[model samples]
Target: MRLMRIGEPGHERPVLASPEGRHHDLSSVTADIDGAFLAALADDPGLVPEPERLPETDIAGHRIGPPVARPSALLCIGQNYAAHAAESGAAPPEQPILFYKSPNTIVGPYDDVLIPRGSKKTDWEVELAVVIGRRASYLDSPADAAAHIAGYAVSNDVSERAFQLEESGGQWSKGKSCATFNPLGPVLVTADEAGDPQGMRLRSYVNGEPRQDSGTADMIFGVAHLVHHLSQYLVLEPGDIINTGTPQGVALSGRFPYLGDGDVMELEISGLGGQRSVCRPA
Candidate 1:
């Protein structure tokens, strides 16, 4: 199922996108798409009631917000893709290198991506995000990671290279947590619908020009390994989001120019829908 939230920022309503390309309101069944709703659906897939088709005109003009409500944690994996790590002048880590993006960075898929104050190296990363459905801590094995995932979504891990490197005291979060730095989801597709998370094609474009083009198949540490590895250090609760890193092609590599005001960014994953954001000064 392709679940979503639609309306203005902070006032979105839960909806389900039908196979026929129409939207059906899911508010009657759940107040919002969040941890509780995900857990409930996991217990009983039939918990969602018959969807009421929304008028095409209304949906066509409305804004699309992040699929899930505010999550408890916004976690990220660094250099999970070998090619990406090489471009950044780093080697593949022996274990999953983790980082955090402040939950406040979350924004709608199509919202404007803010270029932070005094910023000059803002970059784009198209990644596949995993949403946790069940609580996980010290999992028995990587195979168990599947049962804990709610679904997957398209995530743009927007970054500020200068703040991340020169000014961050070596910590990456400083450059990753600016407001609206993470533009997530036009939809959160269920795991069943997303199929294999490690085989999807992820691509990014700036102002209609291709920038990053790669596949999850190139990931050095796949989704299951990251989840299991992370659970050993901290609890992965429902609604927690894990951004599984990007595959090469970003401004940080000096391959393309950094984002500037009025630049448009378009990102997509094969099954998880796409995102489009216009860069603007904060």
Candidate 2:
């Protein structure tokens, strides 16, 4: 199922997309798409009313918000793609390297990306974001990670290279936690609907010019392994989002210019939908 939230920012209503590509209001079933709703849907998808007889919403007329309500935690993995590691002048690590984005950074997919004050190295990263469905802690194996995931969504891990590299005191989150940094979804597809999480094609374009083009297959640490590894040290709760990192091709590599006012970014993942953001001065 492709679930979404539509309306103006902070006032979105939950919705479900039908097989025929129509949308139905899910407000009658749930107030918002969040941990509780995900847990309930796991038990009975029928908990969401059928769209056939319901009044269809004009999706194009409304703004699409992040598929889920504010997640409890916005976690990220760094250098999970070997090419990205190489571009950043690092070798692929044996284990997943983790980071955090303040939950406030979450924003709707099509929203404007703010270029923070005095910034000159804003960058783009197209990544596959994992949405957790069940609480998991200290899992025994990679196989168990599947049951804990609710679905996948396209994510742009927007970054500020200067703040991240030179001024961060070596902490990457310094550049990653700016407001509007993480543009999450146009839709959150169910795990059953998302197919193989590690095989999707991901791409990013700036002002209609290609920037990043790669596949999840390039990931050094796949989704299941990251989840399993993370569970060993931290509790993965329902509604927590994990950005699994990006493949190379960002401004930080010095191949493309950093984003500036009015520059637009477009990101997409094969089955997870896409995102577009226009840069604006903070």
Candidate 3:
């Protein structure tokens, strides 16, 4: 099922995409697409009722809220892609490089991405995000990691490189936690709905010009390996999000120009759907 949260920002409601490709109200079953609701929906499909028809609202009329309403933690991996690491002048990580983005930074799909105050070198990163369904600990193998996954979504790991590196002295999270930095959603596609997350083709564009374009096949640390590695350090809970990492087409890559005000971004991964956002001055 392609589950989503719709409506206005704070008043968003739990909704499902009907077979007819329309949004069907699921408010009768749940309030929002947060942790507990997702965990319950993951366990019991019967709790949600089948709809004969979708709502009459325009598909484009509604705001696309974050696939999950509130995540316990927003974990991100740095340089998980070899090409991206090399482009940034860093060696491919010997271990999974981890960082945290506050949940407050998350915004809905199609929302405007803020350029962050005092920021001159803001950039975009299109990443494939993994949403955890079951609690995970020290996993024994990469094969077992897939079972813990609930679904997948498209995420923009927006960055302020100057603050991230030069100003902070170190630590990527400093530049990563600015407000409205993470634009997520369109939908949270269940693992069954998003077959082989590792094999999908992913692409991104800035102001209608292509910037980042690559496939999950290019990832240095695949999804299952990331899950297996991350669980060794922290307990993975349902609703925890891990941005697997972006490909090598960001502004930092120096192949394309960085973003400024009025720049729009569009990103898509095969079968998972597409998401677009506009960049504006903070």
Q: TM-score of each candidate?
A: 0.97, 0.97, 0.95
Question: Model 2, 196: alpha-carbon shift in Å?
Answer: 0.4
In order, the Cα lDDT scores of the candidates are 0.92, 0.92, 0.86
Task: Give candidate 1's TM-score.
Answer: 0.97
> 2 or 3: which has the higher TM-score?
2
Give the residue spans of candidate 2 off by over 4 A.
Answer: none
- Over 4 Å off, model 1: 50-58
Least well predicted 10-residue stretch by lDDT in candidate 3 = 50-59
* lDDT tens per residue, model 2, 1-282: 899999998899998998788898887788999998887777776776668756688888788999989799999999999999999999998989999999889899999999999999999999999999888999999999998999999998999989998999979999999999999998999999999998899999999999889999999999999999999999988899999999999887878899999999999999888999999999
Root mean square deviation (Cα) for candidate 3: 1.7
- RMSD of each predicted structure: 1.5, 1.1, 1.7
Q: What number of backbone clashes does candidate 3 have, counting pairs of residues 3 or more apart or in separate chains?
A: 0
lDDT per residue, candidate 1, 163-261, as tens digits? 999899979999999999999999999998899998899999999999988999899999999899999999998889999999998998888999999
Selected candidate, larger TM-score, 1 vs 3: 1
